[model samples]
Each structure stands twice: as structure tokens, then as C-alpha cells.
Target: MDAPPTEAEVRDRLPAGAAPFAGRRTELAALATAAARTVPGRGRLVVLAGRPGSGRTSLAVQYARSVAADHPDGLLFARMSAPDGSPVPPGRAARRLLEQLDAVPAGLLPADPAAEDPACAALRTALAGRKLLVLLDEVREGAQLLPLLTEEPGCLVLATTAGPLTGIDAIDPVILGGLDQGAAVDLLGELIGGTRISCDPVGAADLAEACTSRPAALRLVAGRLRADARASVTDAAAELAPAVPAAAPQAPKSRGATKPRGRGPAADRRQARELLPAEPVPVADTDPLVAAFGLVYRSLPAPAARMLRMLTLAPTQTADLRTASALVGCPAPEAGTVLEKLAALELLEREPAAADGTERYRVPGRLYPRLVELRSEQDRPAEVELARARLLERLVRLVDSARLLLDRTAGGNPDPLPGPLRLRTPAQAAGWLAEERDQLLDAVRDAIGQGDLDGSAGRLVTALLRALPLTGAAAPADLYQLHELVLRVAERQQAPRRAAAALLNLGDLQAAEGHWPQAEEQYRAALDRARAAGDEPACARALEGTAGCHRALGDPVRAADWYGRALALRQSLGEPRAEARLLVRTAEAHTAQRRFDEAGREYRAAVAVLRRLGEEEAAAALSQALERLRRLVDGEGIVQVSE
Candidate 1:
């Protein structure tokens, strides 16, 4: 499963190492004082609220790390919302938290809805009296934090939100305004060097003011300065001056009042107009952080600039070189250079490189909105849609390529993509699928949501669904949702074959969850769609699903009948593996009906097929079952179903 990043991963995203956090002393002291004053019964909730890029998350992480020893149990972190600004369902959030605490196994699915939330219950029990610190970042609302809150006074809850988390009880909010000038300059000094700031203290102060004392804005300015060693603070400030709002024009003298100035108001107004930028900047454009973003954006070369605009359409939260390359229709080497340049400019945050040495980058949460706005303002609708289409097509081919390499049942070699994307081995293929699981899900959403009713979206989603087991990346509920999404897309496209495949996938999930009736309903629906499409393989799959559901529901006769039909279909299709699997199912159904002789015959047939297919392990297992069945029949002993 793609669990939330561990504490170490979260720390990597924080402003640590070379980019030291230089401000928030008062806030840290406040948190420390609060910890010192903790009462016995109830816990303390300190919410760090601020605008995007105001350093709320960084401060929280810094404070948590400083006091790690105080919470010997653990310091856990959970993002209350996804990077795409969607609130994570509380149940899912609870599961992630519990996994972090090692209270539940990773990738464990939730209990049945009819039962209580075992995940949340287990979390509460596990955290009942521990001296733990929970950092909840990107919290969207007060209610979103409730499920994750604990009542122990020994525990400390530090939550970060874009705005005030109102209506929560006993809440202590540390609203993070812009940094003080000294602190902002200190941050600049840290980025560059104190010697540079000492040389032109006035310019450093002016630059801080121009950046509105926002840490993120300062970082951008500092990044630019560091990249060009000869660039001074004054130079950076002047470059950003156009984005800063000019002082409001003095009100015109009243009609009755006489002008006593040396130069008339008209001349002054004309001169001021000439001094202003040719293009009018919006109110939001006046924001220092936004201005800094614009400054960095305008400095980009044409290809990098266009790639920045199209990056908002990237389905993944963090993009690797392949995704970046596909977004701009560029080669991998060119895309890598562009990505590194953006990272240097602080336009994107560079994540640790993947094990395969693929460079990854993300549009910082605070910067993403501005990037999206730029896409809307600079790129035409057609251009944006083309980028979106290219990205989706790239994702489809990559996923299909990975699936082909992983699942032998998925016949045919992957085509279209060049050598780099053709995942060579099963391990490599599965790892790629797992790493990009969420991105794949988001791509499916994008594919369908973009009004592609021509079955392309369904095909993309189906490709991912077929590879779900090999990846084992998604939780059962998430997989179920994706299947439903694919089903809807298939139905809208009037693609019966795709719809049947989606239905069978849904049926398998339901059966795994022990919902026999629901599983049967999905299987029956799939059977109808398969018949309508005259898709024999899909029909066989649906038959197999229905047979399993019937067997689960204790209808052995129906199970045996359906299994026989599915087995016949597989045999006719020359699918030896599928035939062997159905034979085993048929043997189980016969054993359930107390037909020991028939069960032994079916087991023997399955063993022969397994051995012919070089499946030694399966053949040996089935051979043992066949011998056991013979002994049971000869001695008139009890017939037990195979494990």
C-alpha cells in the first residue's frame, strides 16, 4: 500500500538541512510553554493557521522535532487533506494514523460498515495514554481533525491549516503572519550568507519588505540570488518591483481648492502613468509571494515556461522526469534539465530522487494555486486541453506497458513507448505501478472527468484495474471506488466489453470482502454485459465470478454448473492456467456436494493441466489433494474441502 510518508519522509519535505528555518521563535516558545503547562486530563490543541507558504507546516515540524524526546512514544504526522486539496475521509485518515503508530498492519482494509470502525477504535486504544505528538498538516476544517484527536494530556496535538480552525473546543491558534523583517533577513542570510546581507543591510531589508516578509517569498528571492552570485539584493528587489503595488495616487484637490504645487497634477499623473508597468497587474498579482512566483516564471526559457503552465495538468502530486517530459512533449534529458532549473528557482520543490535515480519534483502546496492561475491566464484553452490529452495518453501507455510486463495473462508486448518506459522485469514493473498508484488513480479521474466519452478513459482505467493485484498499492475501498468510476465511464461510452470487465473487477472485490449477494449482483450484471458484447473471455471471467459467489452463498449445485461452463470456455480459448483454476473450483463444488468420486476426477484433471503448464508447486499441491480424495473415497471417510 502507498502509506502516507513516514516521519522521516515528512521531515525531508520540511525546511531542514541547508534551508534552515530562521523564524518563528516566539511561536516555538509558545508551544514549549504550552507543553510545560499541560494539565492531567485533557490534551492541548495548537492550530498553526496561515496563508499558503506562510511556513505553518515547517514550524510545526521544526517544533515537533525539537521536542521529540518529550514524546518518547512517537511523533506521528498525517496530512488531513490530499495534495490535490481533497479532504481525506476521516476513516481513511484514521487508518493511516494507526498504521503510523504500528497499531495496525499497513494496507489493512477497514472493517465492514455494519461493524464499528476497528481502525479508529484500535487507534484510540493504542494512543490512550502515550506521550505522543501528532502533527496534522493541511487540515481543511475543524471537523477533519476530530477523528485524529486524542484526549490524553500527555499527548500534544499540533495542527496546521490554511485558515483558522473555528468551532473546536479549547483551541489555541497561532496565526502565522508574515515574518518580521529581521527574521526574513535572517532567513535570507541563511540562504545566501550573512556577509552579503551585512554589506547592504538596507537592500536586504528592502528586499524583505518587497517579499512581504513571507518565508516562501524570501526563499524564492534568495534562490535567484544564489543562482547568480553577482546578483545583489537591490537587483532582485528591482526585478520584483513591477509586481509590488505602487503607492496609492494622492487624491485630487477639491474643485474649490487651488493647486499650489510647482508642477500641475496633470503632469505628475502623466509621469506616474509612464513609470507604471505597461500591463496592468491584478490585485492578487500585487501579493509578494505571487509577485515572486511571477518573477521566477518570467525568467524561465520558453520551453520551461510552457512546461510550468502545463504542470498543473500533471495528474501526479509529485512528478518524475518521465511525466515532466510527457507533459511538454520533450525528450527525457531536456525535461530533466528543465525540472532541475525550476527546482533551483524554487518554482518547484525537489524531492529525494527515486531508487531508480529518477529525479522527482512537486509544485509546493502554496505555489500550486499560483501555477494553476498562470496556466489559465497565459495558456489558451486549446493548448491546456492538448497538454491534458498528451499527459493522459502518456499515462495510459506507461501503465499498459507496466501491466504487460507484470501480468503474463495480459498478452502482447507493450508498444508505442520507446525502450526507457518498457519496464523490463516483473519486480521493476510492480515497483513502478506501486510508486505511481495514486497518480494512476488521479489519471483515471482526469481521463473520465475531462469529458472523454469515447471509451478511451474507460480503457485507461481498465488497464490500471487489471494491474491492481500485482501492484497491491490501493486499499480495498479505494480500489472499489476506482472500479465504480471505470464502470460509469464504460457505461457512458456505451462500451459493453469494458463495462463487463469493470463489473467483474467489482465482483471480485465484493467477494473478497465477503459480501456474497453484492458480489453476485455485480457478476450477474457483468454476465449480461459480456453477452451483449459477445466477449467470450469476459463471459468466462463473469461466469467464474458468479460461480465463486454462488459457492460462497452455499449453492454448490449452481457453483458446479457455472464452473463447468467457465471451464469449458477457458479450455476452448486455450487458456491452460484459467482452465486449471476453474477445475480446482469445480472440484471444491463437487466436494461440497459430497461427490467424492467426481471431486477426485476434477482434482486429477487440474493436476495434469498444472503439471503440463510447468506449475510444479500448484501441480504438487493438487496431486496431494487428488490422492487424499481417493483415500477418502476408498475408506468411505469424510470429504474435506482443500485449503
Candidate 2:
């Protein structure tokens, strides 16, 4: 392992935002004091609890960068909430942090490593004795932070949450609120231009006040300002201010009211009227952020506004150009321009470019609910369903293309996939899979939720089973779940062939984990379904799976019987590659039973098929195994010549 990053390097590696981090000076001071008061051999945790758009994230990031020198081990950051505002499980967070540290090798982890105790153990081991600064952002609950917490005294954990975190001991809670007027103004100046604020100080102050001094709301206002330079601060302030109804004329107060200037009876009657507003403004329209968003949203070009609304239906909160294009049913370039506009207006956050140079954008947490509302009120149900269908189609095509590039099967060279989604090489395919794993899984759930429209969901699930390897992106547990989900969908759709394929997939995963009995059970079930459906290919695969399971359990006779059935099916199918593979497997079963003559015959038959198929590498490997077997038989002086 390399040495921990130096303080200077940590400073250099801090996350940089488009604008300078503003405000939260008092909050930063409290954090500094908490860090200074840390006891020896005991870590300190500070939870920055606040509502969304309160600048908790900015405060946490700012504090982390400021104290980078104190903790030289390194700085680690993980978001505990997923893009769709759901809590990320602690184990998933740990695995992610472990990946960041590069402390646990990927190959050493099992599929569904999150459920593995070893992952948390590896994380604890990696974090032990290190003076690291760990930032857990958007933590949903106190329990979610426990597994990720380290006992190392030298480290500090700074977490941000939307509400109070319970079930924690001796946690220092720092409440984050809106920024002060000065800081808000400065931030707004930085976003639009300092000259605009400098020209009209009072108007800028009113605008900041109108935003309630919230950073997120201020940024939205700034977006409006940037969009139209000719628009003045007074104009934005007036637009954001809720309209109040003119007060009704009041009758003169009775002279008798002088009896209760301080009495309870008159005061109670007066308070009732005060509680009701003269004008009942729509709560959504009264909200400054909502109003600001409305202003910006209304200003959008028709295509851009429609695209923004449709985005709320995306499988994930984050989207790339390809995803945006699919959602909007537009070409890529047009979608790119719309995305750039949204990012500019602070409606969407522009993430760093992907390895393939594809631009990505994420919806801000505060804005997502509002976007969903807009989508609901404006878009018809049929339009939303159509958009979802388009997205599902695009995802299926991309996954199929990726599967071809990985080429995990015996199928010969892959045919080229058309369009921008094509993955040209295995490395490229793997990278795309890893990067889009979350989106792909979410898309699967989305499709299943949509009732597997036209069986595309089933096709996608099967493709993923073949495309994603067990190593990095797709966990075994996840694959198993996908198989189960697809099986349910197929059974409900009365598609026996699809259900049999899913059963086979499930068996394969179980067999990989050494669960021979469970695997055989699944294979048997699949065999029954395949036979009922008259699906010969599925039946052959199910038989082959059962044979492998029996072979693994040391039952060579049973394994050989099952393999023979599969071999007959493969031969009848006239697929030379499939026949060769089945022959090799049968040879292994015969060898396990010490049937040397039978094994030799099977091996020779496999070599001839492979050679005829122009699979020289496979043929040579089998030939080498046959020669080794011959040498063993010669030593025993029991060699039998078999054709």
C-alpha cells in the first residue's frame, strides 16, 4: 500500500464547485471548536442537521478543506443518500468507501459484498489508526452512520442530515440555517456578476431577503438574473413576492371595545382574524424558491421546458446526454443544448464528464419534488408512459450492445452495434457497466414496475445476466433478485420459455456459489418448464446445469447420465460449438468415474468438433488433456485403444 496522502495533496484534492463556497462562518467556527476539543484516543462526530437548501453540504465541504492539514491520512467523502433521495444502506456505503481507499481488492469480494461481514471488517481495518477526515453527506438516519463510523481517535466524522439523527452517543449537533444577508448578496454577486449588485445595493438586499437568505433559493434567483441581463433586481423581487389581496374596508370599532384593551375575550377574537390571511395565496406560488423556479421554468424554450418536465420520469436523478435524448425523444445534439441551458440556470447540476466524454447532469435535491409536480400537472399519463417506454427501449439496446462487446458466450465475433451507444472494446464495455450500474438496476426496477411492457423487461434482465460479470459492477445477490423478478414477470405474462430462462440464470448463480443442491433444484424446475414449453435449447441448458451440479457433488454416474441427455439434445440441435462444449463436460464426468476408455472417446470427439469449428485453441487444450490421460493409463498398464 502506498503512503497516505500528504496534507498539501489533500488540500489539492478537495472537491471544487463552480462558485466559491460562501457563508456559514459561524457554523465553520463551531466545527473548528469541536475539532479542537477532541479528546485523545477518541474520535469526534459532528452532525450538521438542517433542512434541504440550508447549505449543510457547503459548510461540511468548506470545513473539510479548511482542516485538511490536521488529518493528513486523507479525506474521504461518500453520499449516504442515492440520487433519487433514498437512503443508501450502510454496507453499500462501506463498500464504496473501501473502493475509494483501494484497501480491499475487488476480486476478493463476493457478489453482494454488501451483505458480507468481511466488507465492513475490511473498511474498519483500512480506517484503523488513520487520521482521516470522513464526510458522510445527506445521511438519512443515525443507524445508517453507525457501521461507517470508526473508533480511531485521530479521525473526525462530519455528517450532514436533513433532520435530527437519533440513537447516537455524545454527538455534537450543529444546526445549519440560511446564510446571512451579506454572504447571500456576495454569493448572488459571484453568480450573476458583481457589477449588478454593486450598481443597486438596496435592490440586491431586498432580493436576498426575498429569497429568505437561502443559498439554494439565491442560486435560483441568480439563475434568473443570469438568463436575462436586462432584468433588474427589483423585477425578480417583485415576481417572487407573493401577491396580497387589498384589505376589506373595516367598520369603526365600537367604543365598548375600550373595556378589553388587555382582556382575554377581545384578544382571542382579534387573533382569530389575524390567523387568516386577507388573500389566500397558493402555498406553492408563495414560496420564493418555487416562484423563482416558476420564473426560470416559464422562461425556458418550449423544447427545454418539456424536456425538463419529462426528466422527472427518468430511472435515476442523474442523466447523461444519451439519457436526456431518449427521455425527450430528440436527437443527441438538441438534447445536449437543452441540458447545457438547464445546467446554466442552476436547474440541473453539471457533473464531471464521463470517461467517454459524455456530459452528465444531476437534479438538485431541493428541486426534484417540484420537477415531479410540474411533470404531473403538465404531462399526460400516456405521454409519461410513452417517454418511459422510449427510455426502456434505449436502455435495452445499450445493454445488448455492451453484452456483445464483453462476449462472455461462445458465439463468434460480435457484430457491430449501431449509433452512439456502441461500446467498441471489452475495457470500454466494462467501464460503461460499472459507471451505469446504478442507473441500469434502477431501470430494471422501473421496467418491472411498468409490468414488463412487451416482454422487453424480461429481455433486459436476461441480457444483464449475461453481460455483467460477477466481479465488479453486478453483485450475485443483485443478479439473483433480477432473476427472481424476471421469473415472476414471465409467469404472470404466461411466458414459460422466459420463465425457464430465468430459472436457468438463477441456477447458474447458485451453482457458482457452490450451492449444488439448490442449483440442481432450480435446474430441475427449469427442465420441467422447458419440456412443457417444447423449448429444446432451454432444456439442454437445464440438463447441463444439473449435470454440473451432480459432478460438483462427486456423483460421476448421475453427472454422466445428465450430461448424456444434454449431449443428445445438443447433437440434434446441430450446433458444433454447443456440442463440443457438452462433449468436454461429459469427458470430465467419465474421467471422474475412472472410465478412461469412455473419457478418451469423449475427448477425441470434442477435439474433432472443435477443430472442425476452427476453434484451434480449444482443440489444443483438450488434446493436451487427452495426452496426460494416456500417460496415466500407460503407467497403470491398463490403456485401451478407443475410437
Candidate 3:
């Protein structure tokens, strides 16, 4: 096989250099201090630690440019990580550095370790007395850079990573966070123009927060804003709002929290999330950020690359082993290994175990869209759909099992004996539903949009609806949006019954929030669809919904009329329990209109049905209501009926 591509080949693939580095004053100062302290025969090493897109590479390039004149031997830059996210062999890095410094000719670096070792030694000897600056981008371990360092006091080594490089005695370390607010705003102004900022100072501030002041993110947003003359800072900020969470203040680094070798993958993920926020970074093919990430991503092993792509299917920013396994169709242990490797490469950040002890991992928000774009380009469309289908199927099963457990427990069944459940208990099931609520909602929305609703999408939608009441995780607006999505999907599929159900559900959500007119509109649509489909149950539900809206709007006559229709439907369908419920509602409408005798007759009818159905408690409640109403009608008790 041809000799592995050299580091220069990889370096050639990266973007030209970080674009006019805008911030990182403190980091630059620290580098300046370290450069000043270098002595002859003792070169200095500085490692920059930060998440991808935090501008570590840009800072390195800028620092090198600023100090180039001090080292007349010239500046050398090499990427320590292969495009596939693996560490480039130190010898490969050394050979590339040698070639850059003109100490070795191209294609002369030996492939054999025994020969390469002496070649690297000779190269090091030649560089011992020279002054140079070496910038290593995406360095993983300290060893990768150690071979390329020279003893010459004038030579300086700079490196960057998502975390610290342990086992390397770094002379100085600069931990780069997002740009300071002022620097971030200034950077945006530089890109998009001062007029945009001047027009909407508050929106500009919001944009900064939305980007978490990360330079790479700011650059992308500014690039987009600059391109679209009509796009206001506020509009861009709003577009980015969903991806930006409130920035969690960076925790002070504990002196003792050095990188540990062989830490379990679970521990690694936890540390990763703590160091990097989950805020999304925008990635366009032409974006410098994407170009930079693409360099490392292209270097990842095929398995690791696939894992990274499947990760984009994650419902939330973070995913656990089970989720990963489902997405990739692998065993959990194997999935964990893949995750650990990806985390090592800094493609995925490992987060702390949740309370239930499930290890979690997240693709850096900025990297997620980039990976997704790559996956779309690299993987066939059918393959992507297959992966998504597998994940949705798994989620559907999980939610179905959890709902079963919840229903069984609520029906007076004894507490489930301690055993493994898809979800451990009803309480745990509810919590899981709440946590995955957004993801589930997103899956449904995407499925509908992509026209994949007839398969796992429909099942997922049904499962989510079944679980939502138990979790109480979604708001009324969220519910309405979800049902609206389902309604669209149903209409597309020409499923009239499903369409009617979606409208009814949407109506219920609106009515619950006291939007009576909107609810009535939705209910009427449902009634029309139900009538077309000959779905009597759906018709009864729609009639009941409209009747409830009318009652809430204070139109007692209309409410009573609609309730009468629903009650008649339920009775004709031989649905005694539903009919009983409708009778109670109808009586309430009559009572609101001061028709106590009519209300009493309806109430007695409801009690008879409930008693026949063995609902003693409900029958007793209605019996008491009827007695009170009769007394009021006979004038034994004065009661004012409000309509």
C-alpha cells in the first residue's frame, strides 16, 4: 500500500488559516509571556484547551503571525490529528515538520520505524540551533507533539484541544472560553457592519447571547446576516433562539482535575459536557467552521464517522448508549466503545451520567449540523432513512411498554414487582417521557415534513399522545402544534378518521386554554370530516367538543343543542358510559339556562345509566345533584342560575 498520507497532505486539506482572528486578547497575552520566557536549548510549549469552534486554531495562527518576525527561521504549522479524528503518528508529524523546515526532502521520510527513527533524530539535530514556531492544531496527546519539539530555546510549540493533554508537562496552558461580550459584539460589527448593530443594539446583544459569544458561531451568524440585506439582527437572533440555551457559566477548573488515562467512557462524556456547552454552532459548506471540522471528520475511521452521522438522529442534544445502539443497530457495549473513541477524537462530548446512571453523550451543537450535512453527502438517502426508521421503531416500543406499565399500575394493580421494565416504574416512565418529550415531538414533525408518516412516524405520534398526559411535559401551544402536524400528515395520507381525530385533539387543547372560538372552529372541521368518514365516535367527540366550547362562551342554548346531538350519537352507538357522561354535561347546560326541570330529568337519566354500569360513586354524586336541583326548582332553596 502507498505510504500513509503525510501530515502536510492533511494540513493542505485544512482552511488556509483562521480568518482575521478577532478576539482572545488574554490568550494572546499568555502566549506572548510564554514566548518571552523561552531560553536557548529549552523551547517552550503552550497548549490551548477549548471546544471546537471556540477559535483555538485561529488564536494559534494569529499568535504565530504576530511573533513570526522574532523567529527568522519561519513558522511551521501541522495538524496533529488525522482527518478521521485519529492521532497522526508522531513520526508522521515529525517528518512533515522536517519537510516544512527544509531539513528533509519530500517523499524521503522512511516508512519503516527503524529508519524513520534515525531520520527524525537527524532532523531534530539539524533544528537544535535554529529558531522556529510550530503550531499543532487538534492535538490529542502530548506525545504526538513531543517528537516534533526542538531543544532550541528560540523554538516555540503551540497546541489546541477540546480538553487538556495529560502526560505532557506543559509550560503554560490557556483555557479559551467564548469571546467576552464586548469582543463578540465587536467581531459581529466587523463582519456585518456597524449600522446593523446601531439599528438594533438590543437585538445585537441578544445575538451575542444566542451565539454564546463563540467566535466561530458569531462569524457564521455575521456571514449569514451580511449576505441577507433584509435580515435584521433580531430576525437572525430569533432564528438561532431555539438552539441557544442560557449559557452555563464555565466552572472554575480544579487544579487536581488533570486528564486521567483510561478513564471510563461515561466519565469522559461527563467531563466533556461540563467543559463545553450544548449551544449549536452553525455550519455551512463554505463556512470556515465547516471546512475546519470537515478536515478532522474526513480523517475519522469509517465506523466512527458513521457513529457521528447516526448521532445526528438524536432526539435531543445528548444521547445514551441505548439510543446510540438503536441508531447504529449495534450492541450497547459496542456502541459505548464507539462513543468513547468519538469522545477521544473530540467529535462527541461525553456528559455525566443521569440520575438513573445512564451515561450520556452529545455532539457539540456547532458540529451537529455539520456532521448532518456530511452524512447527507456521504451516505445514500435510503441508508439515512433506514437508520431513522430503526430509531423510531425503538422509541415506539419503549413508549408503548411504558404506557402499558403506567395503565396497569393505575388500574388498582399492585405495585409492579421489582424487575426490569423498558421503563422501571410508572414514575420513572413519566420522567423519561418528560425528558424525551422534545425529541419525540421533533421526530413526529420531521416525519410528517418528510412524508414518512405512514410508517414509524404514525406510531411515534400515537405513542407520544398516549404518554403526554402521564408526563404533563408539553404546553398547550406545543400540543396544538403537534396535533396540527399530525392533522397535516393525516390529510396527506387521505386518512379521514385520523384527520378527524387530530382536529378533535387540537380542539380539546384549544378549549382547555379557553380559546373558545378557535376550539369551536376546529371542532366543526372535525365534525365535517367525521361525517364524511362515517366515524360516529369521532362525530360524538367533535359534537361534545363544540358543545363544551359553547358552554365556556356562555351560549347555553347552542351548548345544549350540541350536547343533545352528542348524547344522541353516544346512545345510538350503545356507548352507555360515554352517554352517561354526555347526559351530565347536557344537564349542566340546561341548568345554566334556568331550565331546572329539564336539567333534573337529564341528571336522573345519567344516574340511571351510571348505576346500570356499576359506577356507584358517580351515580351517588349525580343523585345528590338531582335532589339539590329539585329543591331549588320547587323554591325550597333559592338558587340563582348564571348563563
Model 1 off-target regions past 4 Å? Answer: 1-18, 34-45, 70-76, 82-84, 91-133, 150-157, 228-231, 235-279, 282-285, 400-430, 453-463, 466-468, 471-474, 527-643
Better of 1 and 2 by lDDT: 2
**What is the TM-score of each predicted model, taking all chains together?**
0.73, 0.73, 0.52
Cα displacement (angstroms), candidate 2, residue 523, comes to 4.5
Best by lDDT: 2
- Considering only N, C-alpha and C atoms within 3 Å, which residue pairs clash in candidate 2? none
* Clash totals for all candidate models: 0, 0, 11
Per-residue lDDT of candidate 3, residues 547-621 (tens digit): 998999999999999999999999999999999999999999999998887798899899999989999999999
Q: Is candidate 1 or candidate 3 better by TM-score?
A: 1
Q: lDDT per residue, candidate 2, 612-640, as tens digits?
A: 98989989999999998888788888856
Superposed model 3: Cα runs more than 4 Å off: 1-52, 55-291, 404-407, 410-431, 472-479, 576-584, 595-643
